[model samples]
Target: MHNIPIRNLSARLVDPFQREYYYLRLSITDVCNFRCNYCLPNGYQPHPERDKFLNVDEIRRVVRAFAAMGTEKVRLTGGEPTLRKDFVEIVENIADMENIHTLALTTNGYRMAKDVAAWRKAGITSINVSVDSLNSRQFHRITGEDKFDDVMRGIERAFDVGYQKIKINSVLMKDYNDGELAQFLAWIKHRPIQMRFIELMQTGEMDHFFQRHHLSGQLLADKLVQQGWQLQPKGRTDGPAKVFSHPDYQGEIGLIMPYEKHFCTSCNRLRVSAKGKLHLCLFGEEGTDIRDLLQSDNQQLLLQARLFAALQGKREHHYLHQGDSGVRTNLASIGG
Candidate 1:
């Protein structure tokens, strides 16, 4: 597609609330193999009527536009991004862009042991793996995958490669893995991993499940503070995680509490679906299609104009606190 000259692109993507976006989460696919109870309990279903996900060229054009508009970080997400045969090629294409400094990835970690080194060489600067529970049985119950040992091996394999520190994402749920926080902390005490605890968020399809299992992340934050863990300041491109560090532990704790007051104040990221639809917020309205503008390099100016117009309508914050999850039925579809 398009490779508009970088110098010709001079506008930065900013919202009405004055939030300048510097990070872009681009989903490569919505097909995940794991059956996480919270996200895709039944497994990923393909819609025959929908168009196919973005190809390498289309993705390159999208990232190019963002990079020229001052987006510095790009996170390659998916139901599992590595599942694509062209995943490495996609990584290489974006990694070679001019203004994008950080090329990160979020995965389920099933293939990390087999393909991490190749990914590192292709320009993946950081990795975040989903490790819901330390207990094998509990993890299986949560993810519906019996490969917990294999996933843990994959993490160790990551360390063996060149990753100085890896981020671990765990969705905390009531009466599920909530009681195992101590076990998680002990495991990461001597490691360089950042354990991120995300509160279970409600989606359109998971109302009853949310009512049954949702837990507040503030409780964990309060506990950490009482235990002498000091809160760390966030970086410009950091996600919505309140990180905590301790004097004795090598690892850090991050709390992602969507229900917390002013949780969206530090919002600095935007999302684009696998099919090239820009999503203004995680829990906002349906996405705006931009695939037509990605077909040729001549459409770069129009695509940038469309992006700027869309940002003007972005809501100040997500409606999660008001019991509204917007059009999101599951996180997998939007690369959450």
Candidate 2:
């Protein structure tokens, strides 16, 4: 039995697992501009109505409700958040909220050059750009799009603005960009950003590409050290990433090892889909539609019930341990 007081959402303000989860990943849209081979298969079809996304007002209301229940950080993600017509409007609304300490975005960076200023004014100070490779051929091969130039322009422009802690998220593939890890490190050493090496989990469109070259985070780190890289433990976060850095290297490296091991015990985060479904775990195929409860007659009571339901819904660990591809959802559609 826990003695902590229940907040507005009937959230015990403490998870049963003993972790204080204060961050919420909100997927505002399921649409994306680029069709990364790993994210979606070749025959992938975009959502029919990308314009029919969750309105800014609804997003704010939900953010406020979650904040009341101890949500202090929020990240706006999508197939591409920049692709949203009112993406800036949504960020502005969340940033103005008194309770939210951080409001960030994860994008392919195709439109960062155009939206960095607006995003900064709207209350998003940090941004994560997904760049799979620096080589043009590899870039096109990975993203299946030729918008690499646009993405590069976005990165430069983002740094030009007040946006600091700019992070480059690279999903490592087995046979594809596995050998270019050193090139990635060399590039980041001179820049003012953090380069992240994410272990590709066997899931989504990449399921077919899983065994071709599944590299562990440890292997990547070992390679980094072999390249005359000096690293030290930086810190930890709710998500994946065992962070390290090189001496005098302005940027650091984050190694996200979600599938290699599980961190469910201290996990205290929940993700909300664009359509208002609350996910207890990323690999969860089923979710409690908190949208209905939030709009019900007795919202407060319903909210508490929803919280309890979400907690009870939390599986002890993700099914990845079964020797299967652990990633259950697309990273872009879901907030990474």
- Give one clash count per candidate, in the order shown: 1, 2
Model 1 TM-score, all chains together: 0.98
Deviation in angstroms for 105 in model 2? 0.2
- What TM-score does each of the candidates earn? 0.98, 0.88
lDDT of 1 at 284: 90
User: Per-residue lDDT of 1-336 in model 2, one digit per residue for the tens?
Assistant: 012233554565355556666778899987777778777645335666654556776787677667767877788887677778888788877786756777878888887788788888878967889999998888988888887888889998987886767888998887678888668767877887788888777665556576676778888778767755665653223355666777768788888777755546556677888877777777765566767654432364566556665666466677765755344656555665
Candidate 2 is scored at a TM of 0.88
> Residue 179 in candidate 1 has what lDDT?
98
CA displacement after TM-score superposition, residue 217 of candidate 2 (Å): 1.4
Best by TM-score: 1
- lDDT per model vs. reference: 0.92, 0.72
Candidate that scores best on lDDT: 1
